[model samples]
Target: MRSDVQQQIISIIAREAVLEPEDVQPSMTLDELGLDSLGLVEMIFAIEEAFDISVPFNANEPAQSEFDISSVGAIIGAVERLICGQRPEIVA
Candidate 1:
């Protein structure tokens, strides 16, 4: 189940991606959401402002950062971990 935080993030992403909230799903990748690099960066900024959390995201190289942007679910999980004040473990 998606947490309230996750839902908020989804809402932000949906708004930024210019898609309906119902179209945003955990399984969908940013590419699938039609987010270009600029859109992704904007979404990150919106999320940071919305959550009042510093997202350690590097849009240029997401795979190399502590932040994960592989999919909606990954983003939600990373945000949840950050909200819990824990660093996300690097998944192999």
Candidate 2:
């Protein structure tokens, strides 16, 4: 059973990808969805708005950022952790 947050996140990403939510899988990477830098940024913004949580993601150097957006599952886990009061480890 997927949580509401997970479903919403899938919806947001799927909307951006112009695909169906079912097409978005947890193991899939953002790159696999053909999400460019702008798309990734937009997804991040949508997620922040949906969860009302601050994501420490820097678009320019995402790999070094505290927030993880490498894969759909990663984003889901990160959001869940964040909403549950687990702060992202500040990389910088």
Candidate 3:
């Protein structure tokens, strides 16, 4: 379920950043979650590892023009899309 994904993401972020679970929020920005670029990369890796899917990284395109993976919900949505083999909606 969606809650499972949320929990998984929270766990990954907490583990990586050494933060408490209560600190992470569904609407919180990655920066608010205390995740820098390296932390974001680790989060992506954790999501991929947990879901057994590879998240496509289009470095040539702007992030906003790709998937807006700026929050927990967006990250979970992206993972779901990848697992379903569908393209995520690119948010500008």
The best candidate by TM-score is: 2
Residue 67, candidate 2: Cα error in Å is 1.1
Q: List ranges where model 3 is wrong by over 4 Å.
A: 58-65, 86-92
Residue-level lDDT of model 1, residues 9-35, one tens digit each, is: 999999989999889999999999999
Q: Which ten residues in a row have the lowest lDDT in candidate 1?
A: 83-92
List candidate 2 stretches off by more than 4 Å: 86-92
Model 2 has a clash total of 0
Q: What lDDT score is found at residue 60 in candidate 2?
A: 99
lDDT of 2 by residue, 7-92 (tens): 99899999988889999999999989989998988988998887778888899998898888879999988888787774333211
Clashing pairs in 3: none
lDDT of 3 by residue, 1-92 (tens): 34655677678877777788777777877777777777777877787787776777643452744556767778767666676674233211
TM-score to native of every candidate shown: 0.87, 0.88, 0.73
lDDT of each: 0.85, 0.85, 0.68
Scored by Cα lDDT, where does model 2 land?
0.85
Residue range with the least summed lDDT across 10 consecutive positions in model 3: 83-92
